[model samples]
Target: MKKIFLVYSFLFSVFIFGQEKSGAKQFWENLQKQCGKSFEGTVTEGATNDTFRDKKLVMHVRNCDEKTIRIPFFVGDDKSRTWVLAYDNDRIQLKHDHRHEDGSEDKVTQYGGTTTNAGSATLQFFPADEETCDLIPNAAANVWWITLDETSFTYNLRRIGSDRLFTVKFDLTKTVGTPAAPWGWKD
Candidate 1:
Protein backbone atom coordinates (compact mmCIF):
# COMPACT_ATOMS: atom_id res chain seq x y z
CA MET A 1 0.00 0.00 0.00
CA LYS A 2 2.86 2.40 0.78
CA LYS A 3 4.54 1.65 -2.53
CA ILE A 4 1.34 2.36 -4.40
CA PHE A 5 0.97 5.69 -2.65
CA LEU A 6 4.51 6.74 -3.49
CA VAL A 7 4.11 5.80 -7.14
CA TYR A 8 0.92 7.79 -7.40
CA SER A 9 2.55 10.80 -5.78
CA PHE A 10 5.46 10.74 -8.24
CA LEU A 11 3.15 10.51 -11.20
CA PHE A 12 1.06 13.38 -9.86
CA SER A 13 4.08 15.62 -9.60
CA VAL A 14 5.16 14.80 -13.12
CA PHE A 15 1.72 15.55 -14.47
CA ILE A 16 1.57 18.87 -12.72
CA PHE A 17 5.08 20.06 -13.50
CA GLY A 18 5.62 18.55 -16.94
CA GLN A 19 3.48 21.16 -18.58
CA GLU A 20 4.13 24.55 -20.26
CA LYS A 21 2.38 27.84 -19.82
CA SER A 22 -0.86 28.26 -21.79
CA GLY A 23 0.27 31.40 -23.59
CA ALA A 24 3.66 29.91 -24.44
CA LYS A 25 2.09 26.98 -26.21
CA GLN A 26 1.79 28.75 -29.54
CA PHE A 27 5.33 30.11 -29.39
CA TRP A 28 6.73 26.69 -28.73
CA GLU A 29 4.67 25.23 -31.52
CA ASN A 30 5.92 27.85 -33.94
CA LEU A 31 9.55 27.26 -33.03
CA GLN A 32 9.12 23.52 -33.39
CA LYS A 33 8.41 24.08 -37.05
CA GLN A 34 12.08 24.95 -37.58
CA CYS A 35 13.37 21.73 -36.09
CA GLY A 36 15.62 19.63 -38.32
CA LYS A 37 16.42 22.72 -40.38
CA SER A 38 19.20 25.27 -40.67
CA PHE A 39 19.21 28.91 -41.54
CA GLU A 40 21.87 31.42 -42.59
CA GLY A 41 21.87 34.87 -41.13
CA THR A 42 23.92 38.03 -40.87
CA VAL A 43 24.90 40.29 -38.05
CA THR A 44 22.27 42.87 -38.74
CA GLU A 45 23.22 45.10 -35.84
CA GLY A 46 26.19 45.47 -33.56
CA ALA A 47 29.12 47.67 -32.66
CA THR A 48 31.63 48.81 -35.24
CA ASN A 49 34.21 46.41 -33.84
CA ASP A 50 31.87 43.41 -33.77
CA THR A 51 33.76 40.21 -34.54
CA PHE A 52 30.79 38.70 -36.33
CA ARG A 53 30.92 41.33 -39.01
CA ASP A 54 31.40 39.79 -42.48
CA LYS A 55 31.46 36.30 -41.03
CA LYS A 56 29.31 33.36 -42.03
CA LEU A 57 26.49 32.92 -39.53
CA VAL A 58 24.51 29.72 -39.30
CA MET A 59 21.91 28.38 -36.90
CA HIS A 60 20.73 24.81 -36.80
CA VAL A 61 17.57 23.72 -35.08
CA ARG A 62 19.24 20.46 -34.37
CA ASN A 63 17.63 18.62 -31.46
CA CYS A 64 14.34 19.11 -29.76
CA ASP A 65 11.99 17.31 -27.37
CA GLU A 66 8.83 18.19 -25.56
CA LYS A 67 10.59 20.19 -22.86
CA THR A 68 13.76 21.51 -24.47
CA ILE A 69 15.14 22.67 -27.80
CA ARG A 70 18.79 23.16 -28.73
CA ILE A 71 19.85 25.45 -31.53
CA PRO A 72 23.53 25.67 -32.33
CA PHE A 73 24.84 28.95 -33.67
CA PHE A 74 27.94 28.93 -35.78
CA VAL A 75 30.09 31.90 -36.68
CA GLY A 76 32.49 31.14 -39.51
CA ASP A 77 34.39 28.03 -38.38
CA ASP A 78 33.64 28.60 -34.72
CA LYS A 79 31.02 26.24 -33.39
CA SER A 80 31.20 27.01 -29.70
CA ARG A 81 27.79 28.56 -29.18
CA THR A 82 24.38 27.02 -28.68
CA TRP A 83 21.07 28.37 -27.47
CA VAL A 84 18.94 26.17 -25.24
CA LEU A 85 15.27 26.83 -24.76
CA ALA A 86 13.52 25.13 -21.86
CA TYR A 87 9.74 25.14 -21.71
CA ASP A 88 7.68 24.95 -18.57
CA ASN A 89 4.16 25.42 -17.29
CA ASP A 90 4.84 28.76 -15.63
CA ARG A 91 7.63 30.15 -17.83
CA ILE A 92 10.39 29.33 -20.30
CA GLN A 93 14.15 29.57 -19.97
CA LEU A 94 16.77 30.59 -22.51
CA LYS A 95 20.33 29.49 -21.83
CA HIS A 96 23.59 29.88 -23.71
CA ASP A 97 25.84 26.84 -23.95
CA HIS A 98 29.39 27.81 -24.80
CA ARG A 99 32.13 25.29 -25.39
CA HIS A 100 35.70 24.99 -26.55
CA GLU A 101 37.33 22.99 -29.35
CA ASP A 102 37.95 20.03 -26.98
CA GLY A 103 34.27 19.95 -26.00
CA SER A 104 34.87 21.60 -22.65
CA GLU A 105 32.48 24.07 -21.13
CA ASP A 106 33.47 27.73 -21.10
CA LYS A 107 33.54 29.94 -18.04
CA VAL A 108 30.58 32.00 -19.25
CA THR A 109 28.42 29.10 -20.29
CA GLN A 110 24.81 28.42 -19.28
CA TYR A 111 24.02 32.09 -18.84
CA GLY A 112 20.49 33.16 -19.63
CA GLY A 113 17.12 33.99 -18.18
CA THR A 114 13.50 32.95 -17.91
CA THR A 115 10.50 34.68 -19.38
CA THR A 116 9.03 37.21 -16.97
CA ASN A 117 5.57 37.05 -18.55
CA ALA A 118 3.50 35.05 -20.97
CA GLY A 119 5.01 36.52 -24.10
CA SER A 120 3.34 36.61 -27.46
CA ALA A 121 3.54 33.76 -29.91
CA THR A 122 5.66 35.76 -32.34
CA LEU A 123 7.99 37.28 -29.75
CA GLN A 124 9.42 36.68 -26.28
CA PHE A 125 11.75 38.48 -23.87
CA PHE A 126 14.11 37.16 -21.22
CA PRO A 127 15.82 39.36 -18.68
CA ALA A 128 19.09 38.32 -17.12
CA ASP A 129 18.42 36.16 -14.09
CA GLU A 130 20.29 36.01 -10.81
CA GLU A 131 22.66 33.36 -12.07
CA THR A 132 23.58 35.45 -15.08
CA CYS A 133 24.20 38.53 -12.96
CA ASP A 134 26.52 36.60 -10.69
CA LEU A 135 28.32 35.06 -13.64
CA ILE A 136 28.68 38.40 -15.44
CA PRO A 137 28.11 41.39 -13.23
CA ASN A 138 27.86 43.94 -16.04
CA ALA A 139 25.10 41.85 -17.60
CA ALA A 140 22.76 42.42 -14.70
CA ALA A 141 20.59 44.71 -16.77
CA ASN A 142 20.78 42.73 -19.98
CA VAL A 143 17.66 41.62 -21.77
CA TRP A 144 17.59 39.10 -24.57
CA TRP A 145 14.73 38.74 -26.98
CA ILE A 146 13.82 36.52 -29.90
CA THR A 147 11.29 37.33 -32.58
CA LEU A 148 9.89 34.64 -34.84
CA ASP A 149 7.56 35.25 -37.73
CA GLU A 150 6.59 33.71 -41.03
CA THR A 151 9.58 35.13 -42.87
CA SER A 152 12.31 35.69 -40.33
CA PHE A 153 13.74 34.84 -36.93
CA THR A 154 15.78 37.45 -35.13
CA TYR A 155 17.83 37.03 -31.97
CA ASN A 156 18.64 40.24 -30.16
CA LEU A 157 20.32 41.44 -26.98
CA ARG A 158 20.33 44.80 -25.27
CA ARG A 159 21.84 46.26 -22.12
CA ILE A 160 19.05 48.15 -20.39
CA GLY A 161 21.22 51.06 -19.37
CA SER A 162 23.90 51.04 -22.04
CA ASP A 163 24.38 51.15 -25.80
CA ARG A 164 25.40 47.51 -26.09
CA LEU A 165 23.22 45.80 -28.65
CA PHE A 166 23.58 42.78 -30.91
CA THR A 167 21.12 41.45 -33.43
CA VAL A 168 21.12 38.56 -35.85
CA LYS A 169 18.37 38.00 -38.33
CA PHE A 170 17.98 34.63 -40.02
CA ASP A 171 16.00 34.29 -43.20
CA LEU A 172 13.25 31.75 -42.71
CA THR A 173 11.97 31.95 -46.25
CA LYS A 174 14.70 29.47 -47.20
CA THR A 175 16.63 26.63 -45.62
CA VAL A 176 20.34 25.97 -45.56
CA GLY A 177 22.57 22.92 -45.20
CA THR A 178 23.28 21.81 -41.66
CA PRO A 179 26.82 22.11 -40.39
CA ALA A 180 28.75 19.69 -38.18
CA ALA A 181 27.56 19.14 -34.62
CA PRO A 182 28.59 21.98 -32.34
CA TRP A 183 31.20 21.55 -29.63
CA GLY A 184 30.05 19.68 -26.53
CA TRP A 185 27.09 18.21 -28.35
CA LYS A 186 26.88 14.68 -26.99
CA ASP A 187 25.64 12.24 -29.58
Candidate 2:
Protein backbone atom coordinates (compact mmCIF):
# COMPACT_ATOMS: atom_id res chain seq x y z
CA MET A 1 0.00 0.00 0.00
CA LYS A 2 2.83 2.42 0.86
CA LYS A 3 4.62 1.81 -2.47
CA ILE A 4 1.44 2.21 -4.45
CA PHE A 5 0.61 5.48 -2.70
CA LEU A 6 4.14 6.81 -3.43
CA VAL A 7 3.79 5.99 -7.11
CA TYR A 8 0.44 7.73 -7.33
CA SER A 9 1.85 10.79 -5.60
CA PHE A 10 4.76 10.96 -8.03
CA LEU A 11 2.48 10.75 -11.01
CA PHE A 12 0.22 13.47 -9.70
CA SER A 13 3.21 15.73 -9.12
CA VAL A 14 4.41 15.20 -12.62
CA PHE A 15 0.98 15.90 -14.04
CA ILE A 16 0.69 19.21 -12.23
CA PHE A 17 4.18 20.50 -12.96
CA GLY A 18 4.12 19.21 -16.48
CA GLN A 19 0.97 21.16 -17.26
CA GLU A 20 2.51 24.43 -16.11
CA LYS A 21 5.74 23.91 -18.00
CA SER A 22 3.87 22.83 -21.10
CA GLY A 23 1.73 25.94 -21.16
CA ALA A 24 4.77 28.16 -21.50
CA LYS A 25 6.65 25.71 -23.63
CA GLN A 26 3.71 25.37 -25.98
CA PHE A 27 3.52 29.08 -26.56
CA TRP A 28 7.25 29.25 -27.13
CA GLU A 29 7.14 26.34 -29.52
CA ASN A 30 4.25 27.85 -31.44
CA LEU A 31 6.37 30.94 -32.02
CA GLN A 32 9.48 28.95 -32.83
CA LYS A 33 7.53 27.14 -35.49
CA GLN A 34 7.37 30.41 -37.39
CA CYS A 35 11.05 31.17 -37.25
CA GLY A 36 12.63 32.01 -40.62
CA LYS A 37 9.17 32.90 -41.89
CA SER A 38 7.81 36.29 -42.89
CA PHE A 39 4.18 37.19 -42.87
CA GLU A 40 2.27 40.19 -44.11
CA GLY A 41 0.14 41.90 -41.50
CA THR A 42 -2.62 44.47 -41.45
CA VAL A 43 -3.55 47.11 -38.96
CA THR A 44 -6.82 45.73 -37.78
CA GLU A 45 -7.85 48.44 -35.36
CA GLY A 46 -7.07 51.85 -33.89
CA ALA A 47 -4.47 52.82 -36.42
CA THR A 48 -4.94 56.53 -35.81
CA ASN A 49 -2.21 57.83 -38.08
CA ASP A 50 -0.94 57.62 -41.63
CA THR A 51 2.12 55.73 -40.50
CA PHE A 52 0.50 52.43 -41.31
CA ARG A 53 -1.96 53.63 -43.91
CA ASP A 54 -1.41 52.16 -47.35
CA LYS A 55 1.85 50.69 -46.16
CA LYS A 56 3.24 47.25 -46.78
CA LEU A 57 3.34 45.93 -43.29
CA VAL A 58 5.45 42.88 -42.74
CA MET A 59 6.56 40.90 -39.73
CA HIS A 60 9.42 38.45 -39.85
CA VAL A 61 10.20 35.91 -37.21
CA ARG A 62 13.84 36.55 -37.87
CA ASN A 63 15.72 34.86 -35.05
CA CYS A 64 14.97 32.40 -32.29
CA ASP A 65 16.73 30.45 -29.60
CA GLU A 66 15.92 28.52 -26.48
CA LYS A 67 15.25 31.67 -24.48
CA THR A 68 14.56 34.50 -26.90
CA ILE A 69 12.96 35.43 -30.21
CA ARG A 70 13.47 38.50 -32.37
CA ILE A 71 10.75 39.61 -34.75
CA PRO A 72 11.31 42.56 -37.01
CA PHE A 73 8.35 44.64 -38.16
CA PHE A 74 8.63 46.47 -41.44
CA VAL A 75 6.34 49.31 -42.35
CA GLY A 76 6.58 50.16 -46.03
CA ASP A 77 10.26 50.81 -46.59
CA ASP A 78 11.04 51.46 -42.94
CA LYS A 79 12.96 48.71 -41.18
CA SER A 80 13.47 50.45 -37.87
CA ARG A 81 11.54 48.25 -35.51
CA THR A 82 12.05 44.88 -33.92
CA TRP A 83 10.16 43.18 -31.17
CA VAL A 84 12.18 41.12 -28.77
CA LEU A 85 10.48 38.49 -26.69
CA ALA A 86 12.49 36.80 -23.99
CA TYR A 87 11.80 34.12 -21.41
CA ASP A 88 13.76 34.07 -18.16
CA ASN A 89 13.26 33.49 -14.46
CA ASP A 90 9.84 32.05 -15.15
CA ARG A 91 8.61 35.19 -16.88
CA ILE A 92 8.23 36.49 -20.42
CA GLN A 93 9.25 40.01 -21.41
CA LEU A 94 8.45 42.13 -24.46
CA LYS A 95 10.51 45.04 -25.71
CA HIS A 96 10.57 47.19 -28.82
CA ASP A 97 14.01 47.82 -30.24
CA HIS A 98 13.97 50.73 -32.67
CA ARG A 99 16.75 52.02 -34.82
CA HIS A 100 17.48 54.52 -37.54
CA GLU A 101 18.32 53.69 -41.15
CA ASP A 102 21.98 54.21 -40.36
CA GLY A 103 21.86 51.61 -37.58
CA SER A 104 21.69 54.05 -34.71
CA GLU A 105 19.43 53.32 -31.78
CA ASP A 106 16.26 55.37 -31.52
CA LYS A 107 15.62 57.46 -28.46
CA VAL A 108 12.33 55.76 -27.76
CA THR A 109 13.61 52.23 -27.79
CA GLN A 110 13.64 49.23 -25.43
CA TYR A 111 10.31 50.16 -23.96
CA GLY A 112 8.02 47.39 -22.85
CA GLY A 113 7.14 45.13 -19.95
CA THR A 114 6.99 41.64 -18.53
CA THR A 115 4.10 39.22 -18.25
CA THR A 116 2.39 39.37 -14.89
CA ASN A 117 0.79 35.92 -14.93
CA ALA A 118 1.06 32.50 -16.41
CA GLY A 119 -1.22 33.59 -19.24
CA SER A 120 -1.92 30.51 -21.31
CA ALA A 121 -0.54 28.23 -23.96
CA THR A 122 -1.65 30.66 -26.67
CA LEU A 123 -1.59 34.12 -25.09
CA GLN A 124 0.53 36.43 -22.94
CA PHE A 125 0.14 39.98 -21.61
CA PHE A 126 2.67 42.63 -20.76
CA PRO A 127 1.74 45.71 -18.81
CA ALA A 128 3.87 48.78 -19.03
CA ASP A 129 6.89 48.61 -16.75
CA GLU A 130 8.70 51.34 -14.90
CA GLU A 131 11.12 51.85 -17.74
CA THR A 132 8.34 52.25 -20.25
CA CYS A 133 6.58 54.70 -17.99
CA ASP A 134 9.74 56.73 -17.69
CA LEU A 135 10.45 56.69 -21.39
CA ILE A 136 6.95 57.54 -22.51
CA PRO A 137 4.99 59.04 -19.68
CA ASN A 138 1.75 58.92 -21.61
CA ALA A 139 2.18 55.21 -22.11
CA ALA A 140 2.33 54.50 -18.42
CA ALA A 141 -0.99 52.70 -18.53
CA ASN A 142 -0.22 50.61 -21.60
CA VAL A 143 -0.78 46.90 -21.78
CA TRP A 144 0.30 44.74 -24.69
CA TRP A 145 -0.75 41.23 -25.56
CA ILE A 146 0.15 38.68 -28.20
CA THR A 147 -1.92 35.67 -29.12
CA LEU A 148 -1.08 32.71 -31.29
CA ASP A 149 -3.32 29.94 -32.55
CA GLU A 150 -3.26 27.44 -35.38
CA THR A 151 -4.38 29.97 -37.95
CA SER A 152 -3.02 33.36 -36.98
CA PHE A 153 -1.01 35.58 -34.63
CA THR A 154 -2.20 38.89 -33.21
CA TYR A 155 -0.45 41.71 -31.45
CA ASN A 156 -2.56 44.19 -29.53
CA LEU A 157 -1.90 47.20 -27.35
CA ARG A 158 -4.05 49.48 -25.22
CA ARG A 159 -3.68 52.19 -22.67
CA ILE A 160 -6.00 51.71 -19.72
CA GLY A 161 -6.88 55.34 -19.11
CA SER A 162 -6.82 56.69 -22.62
CA ASP A 163 -8.11 56.24 -26.13
CA ARG A 164 -4.99 54.47 -27.24
CA LEU A 165 -5.34 51.13 -28.97
CA PHE A 166 -3.49 49.28 -31.72
CA THR A 167 -3.86 45.81 -33.15
CA VAL A 168 -2.09 43.94 -35.92
CA LYS A 169 -2.93 40.50 -37.20
CA PHE A 170 -0.80 38.18 -39.27
CA ASP A 171 -1.90 35.07 -41.12
CA LEU A 172 0.11 32.02 -40.29
CA THR A 173 -1.07 29.91 -43.21
CA LYS A 174 1.04 31.85 -45.70
CA THR A 175 4.60 33.13 -45.59
CA VAL A 176 6.71 35.41 -47.76
CA GLY A 177 10.41 35.31 -48.36
CA THR A 178 12.49 36.97 -45.70
CA PRO A 179 13.14 40.65 -46.36
CA ALA A 180 16.35 42.57 -45.94
CA ALA A 181 17.96 42.68 -42.52
CA PRO A 182 16.52 45.13 -40.02
CA TRP A 183 18.13 48.52 -39.78
CA GLY A 184 20.59 47.73 -37.04
CA TRP A 185 21.25 44.11 -37.86
CA LYS A 186 24.17 43.05 -40.03
CA ASP A 187 23.49 40.58 -42.81
Candidate with top TM-score is: 2
Model 2: weakest 10-residue lDDT segment is 17-26
For each candidate in turn, the TM-score is: 0.87, 0.92
lDDT of 1 at 37: 96
Sequence-dependent TM-score of model 2: 0.92
Q: What's the TM for model 1?
A: 0.87
The lDDT leader among the candidates is 1
**Residue 167 lDDT in model 1?**
98
For residue 161, model 1's alpha carbon misses the true position, in angstroms, by 0.7
lDDT of 1 by residue, 16-90 (tens): 997654667788888999999999999888998999987999999999899999999999999999999999874
